[model samples]
Target chain A: MAAISVELFAYPWDILEATPERFLDHCVALGVTRAHVTVSYHSGKFLLPRNRSVRVYFPEPGALYFQPDAAAWAGGLAQPVSRLAGSGWLERLARGAAERSIELSAWAVFFHNSALGAAYPDLAVQNAFGDVYPFALCPSHEAVRDHAAALCRSVAALGIFSGVDLETIGYLGYFHGHHHEVTAIPLGMAEKFLLSLCFCPACRAACGSAGVDAESLAAAVRGLLDRRMQSDDASGGQDEEAEHVATLLVACPALAALIRLRMETVTALVKRLSVEAGSAKLAAFTSSFVGSPSNIWMEGVSPTDVGELVECFHLLAYAPDVAQVNSELVFFLALTSDPARVNLTLNLGLPLTTSFSQAAAKVEYALRQGVRRFSFFNYGFLGEARLRWIGDLARIARGDSR
Target chain B: MTELRAGVIGHGYTGKLHASAWLANPHAALTAVADSDASRLAGLPAGVRGYSAYEQLLADDLDAVSICLPTHLHAEATLEALARGKHVLLEKPIADNLRDARRMLMAAKAKGLTFYVGMTHRFYPELREAKAQIDAGAIGEIVAANDCVLEHLGFLNVPQWYLEKKFAGGGAALTSGVHLVDRLRWFLGDDVRAVAGRAGNSYFGADVEDSGQMFLYFRSGLSAQITFAFMREEHPLVCDLQVIGTRGSLTVHTWQSYELWNNSGRQRKVFYTQEPHPAKVQAGIAGEVEEFRASIVEGRTPWPSAEESTRAVQAILAYYESAATGRLIEIGDLHAV
Candidate 1:
């Protein structure tokens, strides 16, 4: 008498705006008992009318759905922008889901308000160097959390979705360590590379409360750097081999503590928010290079840590959309397409299932792996081909279809 | 009765700059240069001894020290120097974060040692002139200010420590944009009340941001916009400031060129004759050194004290909070932490 559980990726807003009847019928046809819907895109609506004649105004005025406590909504409400051709679309989509007996989990990408960044220059992240990254919002800002929570509440109030899935919470990169060719290192090793922790008051206070000696840590780092440079010089400076080893010695524990503290803070915040929501379950989709055995450049995380995170988030309760397992091969190939590295090339081109299937099967084979809760990147591929895999995956997850 | 001797910590770019500045200044004498990199100290100018460990450097008979190490090291080095009864000149962004910044400030204050933040931009002749003019009511009451700092990604490729979250802190905002934010806060003559910002790693793939934008709302009702990026092809280290007021507006280019526009008359005046900061490089070092010297001798307080820098730190943190949450974060919210 167990429920036949199946999770589907549904773009309800887009579907309703495009083909209301077909979208409704498709949900029924797939026997989709549950749907993970994308409530907000990076810039807004994903599927806009193909009419070249339609002029789209960003921040579509009253179109933005906010939580009750959202202070930023005052500005949004005051300005009346055009709604995506279809208004009151969520109600119709919810009705369709209800008719088909499908559960919907409203999914949103938090800390990314690309539209707001463009419309209001004040709401963007500025680097110390004075470059404004338009899409990302400050994680520590109350307004960001409040606004996001407001949006989630609005979606939940519709009586359509079962819960909300907050996708991609702490996904950020520094230009120096992540993008710059010279300083850029593998994602696994990146934690050890940066020269400063955010001296921003919030992070500093958080670190201090966590019993971290930010100054001592910095001093230790400087000491390590000094030692490394000396070692490098002694070794003829031809290679940074000695320096790398020295840095590793000093950086590992420091970086680990820093990351652990940050993760704890973030996890606690998310958990607190979820508790406040009463019924909603919070989930974070995190990308890690530590999943791969070949990620030797950086200290790989212990399997225990992985298990702890899984248990903490209760990931098993909800179906995963696409868990992209990255490794040395993927990172290497993505960085450069050198023919000399055939293994990396092959892995990059291979499917996520192939790259991680063995390890994934060993760990939790029945669980939905490499599955996305909400489609953020590569929507077209995910919508057409990936969803089929996801459906089959849901059936397998339920121990039925396979 | 005795001349003040100082040592330079971490002979990197900033360290070397500090060492050279010390050698050039009369009030302070370069006693020792301590760096782990023996090769980096190979060609030290005459009369300066290079030590492998900071302990050895601290043992030297020095009245003060300039910490030109990484952002994370500023607090530790400065604290050690201060604990040794040495006045300190710590580099900008103060400490890696606010807690460390406060600790450094408190430590220095407790010891009655002169501790000054190396906010070099404040020493720029143009900014100084601009500040003076604004204070004199030449530009009238400040209404708004905007700063854009764009540079090539080449600078992002420093040591790995420059990118690590533990060391460098947050990406562009902490490393490069801090200068702009501090300058804006200084020029506005008020503290940043609230902030909304966005940051991400779209460029290289590090966990920190390569490009970011921040909005700062000063307590004085003056708002400022700052953009920090490593995406540009050219390394254009431009700190262009546009200060608007009810009477007129002033645009500063290169911190030297000044253009003033009278709002009522709709007339513009371009002044290209003013000389740039004469002791620009030495200004921060000299001012900090003089303060340290005076504090050690005359028992006076330093300018741009650690407490003042804390406000700047809070402003940056507010921006980060806004960036992470995609909402307006008040300065009080940041201080609450």
Candidate 2:
């Protein structure tokens, strides 16, 4: 089975911009095979800060963040932003990393966009209730899907990257972590899910083609969420919500059809994107969601058939407690329909979500499950004291104490 | 001035709703009504007369008429009423097609009749105060506005005509989005220069779109995002409108109330809430009918004059055109006198 042996997430700005030789030397000493460099990052405004020392691995060429595209709406042919300003960083780093036999990968972030979504609202995700969540672009729309594919092709076309780590491809829920996001009204988990449901005509037509009455399904969800919103019962008990949702799903066939179709929508997107990415390994970034096995695959989670196109499923095991990691790991092990394609991505530090010991233990656990790869969350985020943990993680994964 | 006799020309659900508003208008007497649907016509009051053809109602002592028929027939009825020297209060869009809307407008102009398009949203008590506040520069300089009015078709009992391309014009946008478009135009008091919209009949599976996202660009450098759908059921109808200004942002959320919050989390506010639900159809129709009657009485155009209504229709039609062509369509192409 194809697998990523060992990888380290890096930022193009941090890893290869100032000192390419020193970065590669660190990689060589740590025994890492690849550098998953962030090719794109989001901001509150359009266009990256101009005249940076390097190009900063910006949006694919002329894809100026949210530049009005005629193809943002569905139909005819999608016009992708084919412009790329040359920084020569990818080429330079790839050449330098090749000297040490280390591969370069574009760690691409798709869908999440504040600038484009703000300037061009047509491309954002709208809920069933018509609230446009400017933080994201609905993958069901051909505009966003095409843009994402074009982004991958652009990065892959550079020929510097051996692989691409696809992150945030699925639906994002209530907590978008926006600045000063005070949702004054209380929204239950199900209410948020209902709000996230996209009944956009393109999505509906897809469901219609699948013989599901998308209209009734949307109505059922709307009705459920409306009842929840009106009823002052603020019981946020996790298990009860799950049971209630299960009961609601069983009661409403249309809602179930919609749920099934949402899964299909996400899978179809990955397949299309994976196909668009020519000559590059496409690894999907799964969330740190801890749940009973089936929950792992919800909200555009890859179904079993996705393995046919995707190279690897990168599961983000970003839990702090070792016990929580082990619990989810067991479920993930039993839950994975395809074991050969799964790899564990442990977070070293981000808002201190996970400790070094926990990350190491999770890596050990994944290795025990016959996994051959380990990709760290990132480099440059950790301070000097915490950053030393990367050396230990690499050495431990590589089976070298020194 | 003998209670300028008024008649409702369509007895469908909307036509019936218009009838109640007409009756509630003390200045206008509900003298007669017309509908091809005999059963719907049979539900009229005892003193109220009924006619199989709306033309026959225009032939009566009617001083004014409400064109609430199938959208395809709205123009015919409106032109007929205007030609017969009767003032007219037309339901949305003027007509299903541009040619018909133009004819009706010209007829109303030639007759010098009060031509009022039923933009009931403008009459919402909270919306009125909100508009006053914005006009009074309560939120300071305008930055951008994001408004949405999403509802569900499953609960709609939507008539067949609503799905018919010939009768309904487009779909949900034509039927419902005009309210939001009209409101935005009124709020900003600026003409829409261009539009970029992405719309589709995603869920309802009809010729008319049930969902859409519209970007309205104003000539004054102001912008607004409008999302309208007929696709929500359990959740309350989404009427979340946020107006961001340089000083602060005013948000009227979930049909309950409006508040102003600064870019910083500090200085939050809570405006007093208005009840009876903003989505309730009966909430503001009485005020709309009164506006129509007063316009007739005062011999002037309505607050949102017929031309303004034309602009709203033109902008939304451009939205559909934009969605269709995948181009930012100019609202000028469709805007006509």
lDDT of 1 by residue, A1-402 (tens): 234444445443334323333455544544455556666545433222221111131333223332333442331212222243233345545655665566766666555555555654344444322345555554444555555555555555555566676543442333212223453222223233433233334444555877777666656556654554455343232222435534654656755566566555455446545644456554443333222322212221121232233211212211122323233323433432331211110111124333333322322322222222222122111323333343444444445645
Residue A369 displacement (Å), model 2: 1.2
Tens-digit lDDT string for candidate 1 (B125-203)? 6667777777778768887888876645532223556567777776777877877877787888778888888887776
Write model 2 residue lDDT over A291-348, tens digit each, in one string. 3323534455654545456777776777677777677666665655555666667766
TM-score of chain A of each: 0.58, 0.82
Compute the lDDT for candidate 2. Answer: 0.68
In model 1, what lDDT does residue B147 have? 88
Task: DockQ each candidate and list the results.
Answer: 0.01, 0.01
